[model samples]
Target: MSTAPSVTDRPRRGRRPAAQLVGIALAYFMVLLDTTVLAVAEPSIMISLHTGVAGVGWATTAYTTALASALVLGGGLADRLGAYPVFVVGVVGFGAASVACALSPALAYLLVFRALLGLFAAAIIPSSLALIAALYPDPGARGRAISAWAAISGAAMAAGPVVGGWLIAVDDWHAVFVINAPTALAVLVLCRTPITTTRRLRALSWLPHLGLAATLTTGTLAITRAGHRSWPEAVLFGLVALGLAYGTAAVDRTSSAPLVPASLRRDRAVWTAFAWGAAVNYALTTVLFSVPLLLHATATAAGATLLPMTLLVALNPPATGRLVAAHGPLRPIRMGFVAFPVGLALVAAGTAAHGRPLVLGLGLLLCGLGVSWTLPALVGFAVQHAAPDAAGSVGGILNATRQAGATVAAAVAGAVLTQDRGSGTAAVPFLIAAAVCALGLAGATTRHLSRTKEAPVADHVAEARHLGHMSRTSDGSSGELPGD
Candidate 1:
């Protein structure tokens, strides 16, 4: 029995001690930058393409759905093919698609190109993290690298909107897409090492998986029939998510080289962190999309121009990183839930008082800061808790859940707004956000509570050692470094 314990409790493989952190950082920057850049360019795209709201929205939808579909596969592909190969392919493919998107003259062409871009972008997150783990074997170094990754990602997201806006103002929607090509090309140029390739590619074809993904994407797209929020449609989408999720689970279980590693799904901590992140994302997307609209509508209704209302939409990404990094992620996540409702309340009050952009902007900033904290922390936690080989799978799952939540929120909130126009109606989404956040907050609190009673005696010894090390390291002239 003791020998059995040792066999089963063996430590998993960790990241290698040496990998180029700079390459990984650059790749992630491109991926995250792409994630948010399109939002600011939407108005310009619509006008230039002569597209309706539905037409323009497909740009986002196609990207997201394609990303979701590719993500699971991307992880498995990484294991078989190699992280570097997958990442390079993703970058080159994404860059090509970006150029296509930029050059496209029609809305249909743009959608197609954007979907193509999504396919490549899907690999960047999981593959990058997997590479990080494969490269950095030491837990402390790996953790620091991941933190640095999170910091870069957060900073990119913060910067994307303004950069996107600038691109739109200076040129056209094409500029947004054009910008990606150079960045991606640069990433490829800098990382010249041949990435690993998967044996899975030779072992089996991807047709079945691709078919399953197609079905899910088709069904998800069908839900955008904004006026068709009937029971039948809801049931249809539910069945689609259910069917695809089931097929994925089944195939993954049976396949020798499954897209999501079987070991990854079994971890309680990973699942919990992923769920929390997804729920928060669902709430945040609703808020991010809604607040700007609310502010613009209010301003327009009050006979004011909406040019200044752009400030509210602009508030979020700028300071998200600094705030989240300053405090440990959990506290910020907790604060985010609290701050969300408070921000909404301020917006509600401000709208009622007068359509003041300043108050609205301030409110949006608070909400943004709150999300910044939660997101990176969630990413870090998910990656850390997952098995080493499964980093890509876990990251994909985490991102997939987050995007799924966002997709659902967009549909549901859009429906609500379509049906009603009242202060109370606006409050409904915020209330739902607050409730979802409360659940996440409760989960966080429970984690803390559970940890409290599991205190190890060695923790005291470790703390004393750490303190001594820190004391020695610190010459009374500088603060102790993290993990000291």
Candidate 2:
């Protein structure tokens, strides 16, 4: 087995560690801000580009599909090339793509640029997580840093709609894309400090990556096409997606260095984290999409209406971090699962009750609280349990699942709404989202109770043994130490 350089062994540059953390968080913030900003600007974009509803939806789908598909590769690249360099390149590429998007004269050009944006976003997400894991070796400090990162994402979600709406009103839809340039540039400036490099792993086969991309793209298209009542097209796409999934699995089982390592695939905690992350985004995005439709509000009004919920989302993470520090990750995560579904049920009830703003707002408040509490815990747990050398890969899997959840949200919401455009139909999507949350809650509860029953060190040691076995099975290698 090849011994990689440890993070502690690397030399530090002149910048303070705090500054490095902030720079990484800011980079993540740009991505989050772009997502919410686009949500608000979709209608304006449709109008400006003279496109139909389907075309407008593609703008979002293209980016998300590309992002989900490319994530594992990004993780692999980060682990090989060093997270700092990968992150820097991603930010620069993202900025250029954003500028291209702003300048696009046609809808096709816009779509192309948006896909490029996703490619870069895929790179940024995993690299940032890997860099954090490397920088803060202490578990407590790392948990807090991850929490802060989650908090910044929440802040971006809160700000995006309001900011995007105002920008659209003042200038045009292009202004939303234009804003990312300076933000990315600023992050680039802050992250000038040198980062320690690690030895690159042997090149993995690209077949799994290709299959993953096909699966994501076809799966998303199938669902969205079904929403539009294009049954034949949907069926064809669904078949293709299924075939790709099978092919990917086959490749994973045979490859010496799979995109998702065997050790990670065997960890229940990692899967639990992935599921919860996906469920949280599924519920959140469902509400974010449905409420706007249910109210039939203008972009500005929609932004205003959503403000209270997102503000809570932004503000709650620091306190949640303190909770994690004191009580451990499971408590807040469990709480989030319960609250998320309850919040969705309330939203469904509110929509059924003729769109009462107060009722809707109350539901949204719970949703925000749920997301704020759960997100940090989910990230912290995943990183903590993962093999230290594979931080970027683990991060990739986690974020890929989350992005897939978002894609599912878009497809499900689109289908439900297209079938029944009435305000009352909003309840159906929320109820579906609630079901997804309940499944996540069940998974979390099982893991939490199981952990409670075992001595913590015993559990860790068992997991280590399992990882060791997995590594040996994969390629006659020993496992790296589990990260705290």
Candidate 3:
């Protein structure tokens, strides 16, 4: 018998399933909105706080690094404690952290509170998805629900800059953080309804969690210091991170319940999806980070420029879901990979041409379309390929990789921009992003094409079996023949 509980088994005492989904989506929206809003408000923050570019960059870096480091542990906690409870706690904590961040008197305090925000955010992400999965038991409905979730996130990302810029213009950067309080409170109220809970899994080993945290934190710090610090120091950080990563793998191997279970670690599809997530975000963050500095634009202008891109990102995923349902994920994913580099190249050209508005606009549009095409499919594939009971873990790992990519992007972009705060320097990061997109494209084409070729053969076999046809062998046993 299947161990998974039926959806109908639970009593419907609280909110309806649709209400639950909205509540979860709102919580997720708050997290994504905060990230994008900060991107727009970052320049204002530097001015208000009397900090350097690198210091302002650390605000984002610290939060994302903490988030990436704690994701696996957060997912494990969700699976053990139940998604509803974990999600409620995360929402309350995130709200408190936002209040603390708004009240921060210094840059150091802001960074600390931002890191706290990330720690709680890690709890919200995976559990939100797990809760959605629990709420919608039907596979097809679940897919649609996930598409909606992605759409909500895309909308929040698009709105963040617009909202943040307006707040900064009207009041101050702190208002951006202050706004999160009400939204989080609304989520808390909506989520007060009871939901079904999952069976608690065995507690995960702590060593692997520590190793993963050390590896990501040190690795991000190493990248952040590149071009700003001595090579020897950067190398030491890198080496230490590498050693920690290796140790994490060793611990994973020895542990009964590893942080990243072998089933997921060994799955090619899962890792490929993770890589795609990382690469796409790396490119996206690089663009979001460098464009405002290059144009010497106001927070409002910066947000407006990015608005088209993020809006497209929001609108494209529902269409992408339709495409995935009809043609499978490979085509759209490959198309996205190809378009991403082209878009970056365009943006680079535009930036080099003294921030030409038309060129930059076109480039951002393409980048948005590219991400919209790929991200839903990538996430869907990751979830589909995960072990049945390990959805939370897989969600955590996927998000962790994406955050790590963002962390690297912010660090590298900060380093590049620090050296030359001119519009010309913006092209450098865009070119680098294009190269990363090309790498993702190459991997997608090579692996997905091989899978595509084999698909027809598998289809033919399935058709023959459906037809109740089999070939007789010399030993008188009937079996499926080659190309049957």
Candidate 4:
């Protein structure tokens, strides 16, 4: 087994450890919170703006598609320009967009502003991980830090409904967005710190990324429209989406500046991780988005109602981190997949049988367990293998895929949810989502998770190299960390 570095091998830092780490986590928390919070508010927004489910679906997809589109480019920009500038700009832009969303008078305006929110969020999500790598350069320190980071940020995915419920009860749909302004302000103030990371000009192919955005946007339009009895138009949009997706891939293959390097694209582990992350998000978002509409309860009531599930999601990551650390990610990851399918199935059964809250609550509890188990392990699995100076890009790729899953899941939920299906039950989407989560189980059982067996210490030196330290040598010299 590999051993921990000695005290002398550790960095001599001029750092505010708590402040810097907390600030970095806060940035991610803000970004993640937006994605889930909107779900609970969707029904209320549809009512307030006099819009249908399709309208709200468009708004939701606009935000996620833009985020998924821009994340790779955002990471590249962070590598080229510097993470600090990119992150700050994203935060400011996100704040402005959130306020704009609050002021939107119509669904059309809300959709545009939500897309703007996503564009800025792309900048925040990927770059934020690099900031964590910068703050905690030691391998063990970095891993633990990332665990906490994932815990906090992951909690947002489950906490959105809880938070949004209270906000909706107090005000209207506007409060759902308006609340972000102060949160964004807090992030800006808290995250102002100094660290340095290596910056090299990264060749970025803008066209492919733009094409990706277009593809998802069109696809979202198609899916959302299809369920609303607009098959002809949806078919037209679907054709355009396929064309755009193919074009983006073609360009990526040929472009000197591909969004993702061809090598990473070809790596089995990388693709597996990306796909699994997408599946995970799809299941979670599907549940979050659909449940509120199904419940027909007040926003606060719905949020409180989901606490059986969300509470576990909010609370379980620390233990998950420890479990993964001791047993490797495979066990927890498997546990998650098991819980996901069972939970989803129970929810489906409960809902189909006429809204049995007890069965539903058990299902929700398992859903939370699944998420809390799965996500941290996925993150640990990916970051443990990154190349030095590629932390932002690696983090970006993982998160972008996760967000992609989240976006499409929301669109799919909206697609199936356009009907006046009464309340407290929608068996079809939940069952489909369950099947998808089951696939995640089979998909993740590759050599990637099993690779820990090849090396007991599990890339300790590689991790240290990946997230470089700011430390004194024998002569008492030191340097700054990366991703400033």
Task: Please tell me which predicted candidate would have the highest lDDT against the true structure.
Answer: 3
lDDT of 2: 0.71
Give the alpha carbon lDDT tens digit for every residue of 1-484 in model 3.
1123222235232557777778888888888788888888888888889987777778878888778777777766766767778889889999999999999889999999999898898788767767776777666676677656655654686788898889889878898899889999889777778666563554656777667767877876777667586678789999999998898899888886676766777778778878988898888888877777676678888899887678877666666656666556666788889889988988888877874888889899999888877776666556556776555456557667877787888888887777777657768889888899899888888855446322233343322221111100000001111110
Q: Which ten contiguous residues of candidate 3 have the minimum total lDDT? A: 469-478
lDDT tens readout by residue for model 1, 1-484: 0011111212223342223566666766676667565655655665678864445456666776676666666655655566677888888888888889889989888878877877787777557766655555566776676556545544554566567667766686688788888888777666665533222332333643575466556555555553345667766766776777777677667765455567775777778777776676666666544553444332112212222222322233224333334443345556666766666565555544445667766665666555644664555455545776566455556666666566555555555554553666666666666677777778877855345332233433222211111100000100112111
Q: What is the lDDT of residue 349 in candidate 4?
A: 67
In candidate 4, what are the lDDT values of residues 1-484, reduced to their tens digit?
0112121222222357666667666766776677667778878998989997667777777887887788778766777766778888988898899999999989889999999988888787657766777667776787677666656665665677789888888888898888778877887777666555546655767898899888888888887777776999989999999999899989888886676665566666656766777777788877877887777788887887677777776667667766665666667778999999999887776666655889988998898888778776666565545443443345556666776787788888787877655443377678788888888888767565565442243443333332211110000001112333
Question: What TM-score does model 4 achieve against the real structure?
Answer: 0.84
In model 3, the runs with Cα more than 4 Å from the true position are 1-20, 133-153, 383-392, 447-484
What's the lDDT of the predicted structure labeled candidate 3?
A: 0.72
Clashes of 1: 14
* Candidate 1, run of 10 with poorest lDDT: 470-479
Instruction: State how far residue 330 of model 1 sits from its true place (Å).
Output: 5.9
Error of 4 at 237 (Å): 2.4
Q: Per model, state how many residue pairs clash.
A: 14, 0, 0, 3
TM-score of each: 0.71, 0.83, 0.86, 0.84
Q: Per-residue lDDT of 50-168 in model 2, one digit per residue for the tens?
A: 87545656677677777877877776676667778889999999999999999988899998999899889888876776677667767667667765655554467678779877888
Better of 1 and 3 by lDDT: 3
Cα lDDT over the full model 4: 0.70
Each prediction's whole-model lDDT (CA): 0.56, 0.71, 0.72, 0.70
